[model samples]
Target: MIRLTGITKQYATKGGMREILKGIDLTIKPGDHVGILGRNGAGKSTLVRVIGGAEPPSSGTVERSMSVSWPLAFTGGFHSRLTGIDNLRFICRIYGVNFDERLAFVKDFSELGSYLYEPVGVYSSGMRARLAFAISMTIDFDCYLIDEVMAVGDDSFRERCKVELFEKRKEKAMLIVSHSHRYLKGTCNRFLLFRDGAITEYEDFEEVYAEYKLLLEEPQKF
Candidate 1:
């Protein structure tokens, strides 16, 4: 289980401090699969990062009893100077996973071929995304944080990711943030609607989706 209490995130701007998340309190259990819905700049990604421990909240406490993953396909965690293979080795070492055992799987899944031997700085966005996704699958985590890049590569690769993360790891907890309601409808059992630095939870996907559409139509009010 993961619990966040009184979570608030702020960023310094020229004018003053800008608050992204305003006193958010959330909890995620082992089997929870939640989809976060929000418009651009609604702080959905910020909330995910905070929950994943990648970013610190300005004022909050995060308690985690289960292992949590970094946001899927988050290239910021990579070392630009290191080769893809080397980066994978570093990650494996940190997680105490057997690098040799996961090497072939990541290689086959990423399909980077010779590019895997090249520095990550030189890889294109798609290649980086592929490497990130492959490495993520190689490690085991109790909870996975997924942003908008679930459909990272081609259709076939996307299907492979879905199979690996959603099908095979069906029991793992997931927090998915995406603009596509159709995609979330199939993957998530619950919904979180983020608006104006706050969140509203809904157990029914269709109900929240309707509210989200309404929010989209009245962005000025929000």
Candidate 2:
């Protein structure tokens, strides 16, 4: 289980410190699939970063009893100058997994061919995303943090990602952030909406989704 208590994230601005996540509290247990929805600039990505420990919250604590994977396909931690193969080895070393054991899987899944040995800085955005996704799957985490990574790749590649994350890892907990309502409704058993730095969970997907659509339609309201 993972528990977040009074989570608050703030950033310095010209005016003053601005809060992105405001006193949020949430708990996710094993096998829980939680979907998060929010408008642009609503701090959804910041919240995920905090939850994944990629960024620190201004206040509050994240207690994770289960292993938490970083936001799926996130390239922020990659060493840009390193070869993709080297980066894979580095990540596997950190997690105590043998790089050689995972190399074949990532090589096959990413389909980068000869480029896996090339510097990540030289790869296209799509290629980087593919490598990141494949490397993410090389480890077995109890809970996965997904932030719009499913939006990457062609339809066929996306289908394969869905199979790997949703179908293959069906038993693990997932915290997913996505704008695709149909996809979220199909995969997530619980839903949370972000509004004005606060988060709310509704029992019904359609109701919350309706609210999201209404937010989208609003001229300026968020």
Candidate 3:
């Protein structure tokens, strides 16, 4: 289970301190599929970062009893100077997983072949995304944090990714934030609408989508 209490995030601006997240409280349990909806810069990603421990909350606590993954398939954390296999070893060390045992899986899944021996700086964006996503699957996380990364590649690759994440990991918890309401409608059971730095939780899809559409049509009013 994961519990966020009084979560708030603030950033320094020329004018003054600007708050992004506003004393939000949330709980995520096993098999909970949560979909987050909000306009750009409305603190949807900010909340995900706070919950995933990528960034700290200004005035709140995040408690986690289960293993929570960082935003799925995030590629920015890799060291450009390091080889793909080197970064894999580093990640495995940090996560206390067996590097040797996981090597075959990553190698086959990423389909990087000999490219894994080359520096990450030389890899293309698509290659890097494939490597990162394969490594993500190496760890058995209790909950996955997904920030608009619905799919990563061509038709067949995307289908494989869907099967691996949504089908194989269906029993696990997921927190998804996406602009595509259709994807969220199919993937999540619980919904959260972010407005004015606050969260409104709902279970019924109709209720959440109705409000989301209203916010979309009149974003300034909300």
Q: In candidate 2, what are the lDDT values of residues 1-222, reduced to their tens digit?
A: 999999998899998988889999999999999999999889888988888888988999999899999889988778889999999999998999988879999989989999998999999988999999999999999999999888888888889999999999989999999999778999999999998899999878999999999888877542
Once fitted onto the true fold, the runs of candidate 3 whose alpha carbons sit more than 4 angstroms away are: 219-222
Q: Candidate 2: which stretches are off by over 4 Å? A: none
- What lDDT is reached at residue 19 by model 3? 85
- In candidate 3, clashing pairs total 0
Score candidate 3 by lDDT. Answer: 0.90
- TM-score of candidate 2 on Cα atoms, chains taken together: 0.95
Highest-TM-score candidate: 2
lDDT of 2 at 10: 87
Report how far residue 13 has shifted in candidate 1, in Å.
1.4
RMSD of 2: 1.4
What lDDT tens digits, residue by residue, belong to model 3 across residues 1-222? 999999999999987988888899999999999999988889999998988888989998999998889898889889999999999999999999999988999998889999999999999988888888888899999999998885666667667778999999999999999988678988899999999899999998889999998888874631
lDDT of all predictions: 0.91, 0.91, 0.90
Listed per model in order, the count of residue pairs whose N, CA or C atoms clash below 3 Å is 0, 0, 0
Clash pairs detected, candidate 2: none
Candidate 3's TM-score = 0.94
